[model samples]
Target: MILAFVLLFTASGLQASKAASCLSQQQIREAIDKKQIKHLAAIKAAVRKVVRGDVVRADVCNGNSGLVYELTILSRTGTVTRAIVDARTGSVLSKGF
Candidate 1:
């Protein structure tokens, strides 16, 4: 049981690290150049409609439909929200509070 607990802890840590890993600006630019993703500005604009807040973090990633931008927003109420925008069309795909 102790060994199982240790393995579970290690696995969770690895998953956390992987989720925390995000693409750098240079990598994002490269993806745009290659037509793999859209510009960050467009993604931000798309997300703005769903929530009123400052963007705390933005990440370019792949989704089931294709490339997407995951935006973390801090709202006026001190609440954090997550928004997913389609990189290709600059449309909001989803939002979570």
Candidate 2:
């Protein structure tokens, strides 16, 4: 019985973590309306200043530093760049090639 309980608890925790990581369209709109996050265009511009590339995909997620915009960009040299931008202030937080 104790083993079963532990398994159940672990499953619940994993599910909660997965749910927290996902952002729905409505949640995104609400964040924007509340001024809790910046617009995508602003995030892209901020990222572009640090990394020259065409944005291929992007997502708004809660990171260790609060809300952030994660962008995947394809550079002219055929390299991929990953950039994290502050969702609220539209600043480039980090980048990786």
Candidate 3:
């Protein structure tokens, strides 16, 4: 059911359908400076607002629409979940995609 919910939400947009290539920390900083994507803090905050969990890891990756934040979260129940946030808009795109 959770997976179904995830798919339902992600199906609307935000395709990582292809192999998502992640950037290194240096590249991340460059992207931020170039205004290509939002700061990591903003991206992480966006996900935290939608998902009740601690963001353990966050990475900027190329998505179908544009840049996206790929986050690994540790839920209150100790379950690990992945989420995606739009880099520019800070919108939650996927919860388990």
Candidate 4:
């Protein structure tokens, strides 16, 4: 029983880590730089307005249509904003302040 519990916990941790590793800072920046995912202009504009100590979390979200680029801006003051961009056209799909 103890061995089974340990295995289960280890497997769960590995799965979590695998998902986290899928989106890295460097990879997300590269995606933006290469324009592989859309909404570069809007994302850049939003980033510029972000206050100091703020950071952006980006991911390739798989929605009903397919994969889309989603960026979540987290400000130092705890303000949060979400933006979804088109993967193919780089257009702004949605934005919320």
lDDT, candidate 3, 1-97, per-residue tens: 9999899878744545433377778888888898988897877766767788888888778888988888889989998889888888888888873
**Global lDDT scores for all candidate models:** 0.81, 0.86, 0.81, 0.63
Question: Which pairs of residues clash in candidate 3, taking residues 3 or more apart in a chain or in different chains?
Answer: none
Cand. 3 Cα-lDDT: 0.81
**Model 2: worst 10 consecutive residues (lDDT sum):** 15-24
What digit string (tens of lDDT, one per residue) describes model 1 on residues 1-97? 9999999999999767746655667878898998777788767776777788989988877677877788889988999999888878888888986
- Compared with the true structure, what per-residue lDDT tens digits does model 4 show for residues 25-58? 5665777688665454555565445433233666
Give candidate 1 misplaced runs (Cα > 4 Å).
Answer: 1-22
Question: Sorted by lDDT, highest first, which candidate order results?
Answer: 2, 1, 3, 4
TM-score for candidate 1, residues paired by index: 0.72
Instruction: Please tell me which model should have the higher lDDT, number 3 or number 4.
Output: 3
Q: Which numbered prediction scores highest in lDDT against the true structure?
A: 2
Off by over 4 Å in 2: 1-20
TM-score, predicted candidate 2 vs. hidden true structure: 0.75
In candidate 3, which residue ranges exceed 4 Å CA deviation? 1-20
Candidate 4 clashes between residue pairs 3 or more apart in a chain or in different chains = 38-90, 39-90
Per-candidate TM-scores read 0.72, 0.75, 0.72, 0.43
lDDT of 2 at 7: 100
